[model samples]
Target: MTTGQRIAAKRRELDLSQEGLGEALGVSRQSIYKWESDSSLPDVDKLVALSRLFHVSVGWLLGVEEDQEEHISNDLSPAQLKLVEEILSRYQQSSQLTAEQQERVSELVEQKVRESRSPRHRRLRYGAACLALLLVLLAGRSLFARLKELDRQYTDLANSVGNITYSVNSQIGSITSRVEEILKSQNSLVADYATNIQSADLASNTVTFSVRVVPKTYTEGLEILLHADTGDGLVDVPAVPGPGQEFSGQITCPLTDSITLSAVLVDQGTRQTQLLGNYSSLYGSSLPAVGISLLESALLNIPRGEDGLFHVRENYGFLTGLSASVSAVNEDIGQSQVKQVQLGLFRNRALLFWLEPCSRPDNHHGFEKAEQWFHLPSVELDLQEGDELVFAALVTDQYGRQIVTPSLPASRVEGDEITWFSTSFDFPSEPDGWGLAG
Candidate 1:
């Protein structure tokens, strides 16, 4: 059906007054009258909105049959095309305009035609010209009406589209914020879990320490220490990484004793420290898999005294005489005292047989070296009740030859607070002295 017929039919089906339809479409009642009378058309974009409102196609609105092409004529804008379709569909099922409105549109067309006569042309020419002018006026009126309708449709559609876009953007933003929040929470959870694990493990087990001494160069050596049972016992292991080299050894308990695994790397001149396979397992197991782990790894700096030499007597007092006598003339004279005395390393084995005298005052010939005894001035002692007493003595004879001797059984009386005297004597003494009387 034609767009006008469709509008008339839809108006009848809806039983709507011309005024009612005009109000819904946001147009003047006169405009609706003109549309149903076939004097004008709606604009293109309005046509599209009308099609959505009434559910149909522009071709059907334009009165094209099913066999005809569905494309609208070029004269129609997108809105007009849609309006045409809505009018058609509504006309077929629900006429929404009044009979009086249609009749009024017809009267207006006729009145306009009558006024068009003029003296400027022949009757035929004037009629034709008048007809053309009337058609032009009608077309212009239709165009204006369609433009108005489309303006209203455009505003409403734009508002709907903007609402949809805003909703989509809000949803997306919310999702992103939630994801970020979850990630942050997860990170905090992981950190908390790690801390808990560490605290739990420490509380559950006993801590033992192992040390690896590594020397960066030939001058550097590795020292490993273990802190076991709350620092009650110490083990000094015997593995060092020399300078410019690397070495590894297994950490055996009681570090003072020997271990099974050992490795040494030779360097040109400088010592170096390196990792080895055996020590790798021992150190690695210190983590979760193994109960034992190293608290600190470093190159140990051994103090000079810890080497177990250099002793001073527990009692520091002025000496009356430091002496020992040997019964055998040709036997080791100073061996007992030299062996008992503690010094730097060991008794100078080179002086294994030389006789030397210690510093002293009372001279029976200005302090002679006995094949037996050499004395030192008594040194004073600020010893506590259970303190240890120690000293080194040398014995020499007139010949100034080296000799060894056995130590006497040291004695202590009650309330004396002097005991635990250990002494050793060696057969040969270096120029200075041999052992420590530790």
Candidate 2:
């Protein structure tokens, strides 16, 4: 269908009279008639308004798509869409337009419905039509630019997606705990805490969190924090120790996003602080999937620190030597050099199999490579699917001089609810000290 045809169809679907539609779009009834007759086009702003009123997309209203759900406000609630539709239905039922007003509306729809003939283009006013077409083209370019911005916003969020919804988070914590137990890792002397997050339904627009904090050494004034920029800014949820204020027990807070999930203990004597546990990563634009359904997916987050340097951290994951492709923002693609892409596999926190992408000359930066596949097969070592692994996609910028960037952990979700890990990301800069993992 033509753009005008789609608009007419949606207007009818909303039970809006031609006069009503024209009033909503701030256009004359004749303009609506011309649009329906395909004699002229509505400007982009009117198209956007029509789409919003119909709960469809501008592209769909303009016949560019049959249906498109990926709009700028994709994260907006579905209930809002339904509410608009209901309100429109009620308005149509009770709306009372004056007899004179009804007569003022041109019965252009009647002409099309009965005769079913396309409107003849008037030769004298062709210039006006051409001008309208130019405006539409300009509007299309603006829409394209808007789409690019949305892609950048969403892609950045996807890279930072962290572990789990409710079920998935509990499962991962349980499995990681088992791994720690089997590894027999030394007891943490600084700070130790268990993290859990909960949130209300979309209607409530509220989130709740709970964490268990324990203090080993720095006993006095010990506390836990689980907070992040929950769409607004960095919100701190102060969770204190359980009972006896002795640095151990559950701490709860009704705060925002499942942010950095850190444990900090303070010395009562000197007020010194130690970062006991920090499982921090960026999150995707949309709230992540609820549970194991997120398996086999990948996420990356580049949370810039106050000092303007990317902090370094180690990570663990499992790999099957399958199709492993890492993504990141290329600050300066021309000068950027992805020196290495490494996947370190381990069992019970012990390194087992290590893999790296093959190198080619003059091709250190493979951003334009046909494929982003890396394989590391060992003849003497046997690999399992659930083995703990850490992925690091290391890239450096080399202008006339080369500067090393900080290293961060990368992970992926397994296909069958296993072997999932987070994607690693780092800022593109020449760090004074780049302590990359081996």
Candidate 3:
């Protein structure tokens, strides 16, 4: 029966009017009307509450089973009563089980009789004892099922909590690493600007650069040395005291010569090598060269696929060509400009795009721009693992210096590509702010 019909039937059986039932259940008369009219389901908690007040099992109240008026008291037969009395006597002295629990005990006894009886006699004598056995089996099965479901629920809860904690911790670690990097870069810049030049020029007469290695954690008594490449071979710059003691030095070189400097961080605590970095230049020299550069240090390395197998999803959108250049503005101060960069290609919803014009002509800071749009035609990209796409943005400083993020580390383009798979498609028009002419 529908929920509405069941509610109405139950009310009639109890001889209660809609208003009386509503008042008893702490609901308005209209709520009673709504329940009887099938407008909505009663809340689960409210249903449980009503079952208690009416002294009826929730299953029977919900019309899952019939309410037997003839068996209102549910008295047992002579034999059944005798067994029940025995079960109760035994239970009360040890176990405090209710009438329901006794029903389970009756089934257990009936099942034992069935198991020991002959096949011919089993069919005929399948009486009260057999009934009791059925009840016990049902009770045991129901309890088992409920326990299993509870176990599953608890496992799900634990996994969900673990995932949340892991995500939170990962975010915190990323933020801490980024902040530490910024602070170290700022400190180096400050030292370069403030420290007095100890000597004019030393060693190599090649392209001049500086390598700064900042420890994730502070350590005492660490020394840094610079490595340079002469035409014959590479040589190490003289050892210098680190910034831990507030020490700094200067080195100058020729324009054509190439050199690299590695920072070997020594831990005074354990007297062991703490960290070893590839030779990197903070100035003039480019990165990913014969030696590593500062930009490499800034990049967060995402491990690539080992087997070179990657699932590539279909491109259900458009690929717009790079059209215009816009200046990246500093969000802090509107007038204070930062970098000039170029816009990379874009797809519908800006799926994949590149940002160029990273550094200034002076090479001080990177660029930032807000709310720029680029328009392009719909195109499908069938990319594989290890395939890279270059993105360029415009970074124009006060001096009109244009810089771009190097092409070495670009977007790794790949997804699951299945041909003959049908997908819905629509074309997009150029919006007002984004266009080929703009």
Per-residue CA lDDT of candidate 2, range 1-438, in tens? 555556655564454545568799899755675565443566655655665677766555554455634243222134533432343234223434345422322132232222322244222122223323333344445444443443443343322221111122223223433543442245564434454444322223333445555555644444444343343455555554556443333333322223344444434444333333322111111121010111112222322245543232322222111112322111111112233333433332344455444333253343332233344342222224343333332332222222221112323223322222432222222222233333
- What order do you get sorting by lDDT, best first? 3, 2, 1
Candidate lDDT scores, in order, read 0.31, 0.37, 0.37
Estimate, for each residue in 1-438, the C-alpha lDDT of model 3 and write its tens digit.
Answer: 544555655564464555567788998755665565443446655565565566654455444446522112122234533543454344333433457766666555555444434343332123333433444464555444433443354344333433333333223223423543454455432222121112211122234344444444444655544444433365555445564554334444332212333343445644322222122111111110110012211112333234443333211111111213311111111121333334544332232544332222333233222123323223345445434433233333343322222211224433432121111122121121123222
Global fold similarity of model 2 (TM-score):
0.21
The TM-score that candidate 3 achieves is 0.25
RMSD of each: 47.8, 24.2, 25.3
Q: Which whole-number lDDT from 0 to 100 does residue 12 have in model 1? A: 33
lDDT of 2 at 278: 28
Off-target runs (Cα >4 Å) in candidate 2 are: 1-192, 201-206, 218-232, 244-258, 269-438
Better of 1 and 2 by lDDT: 2
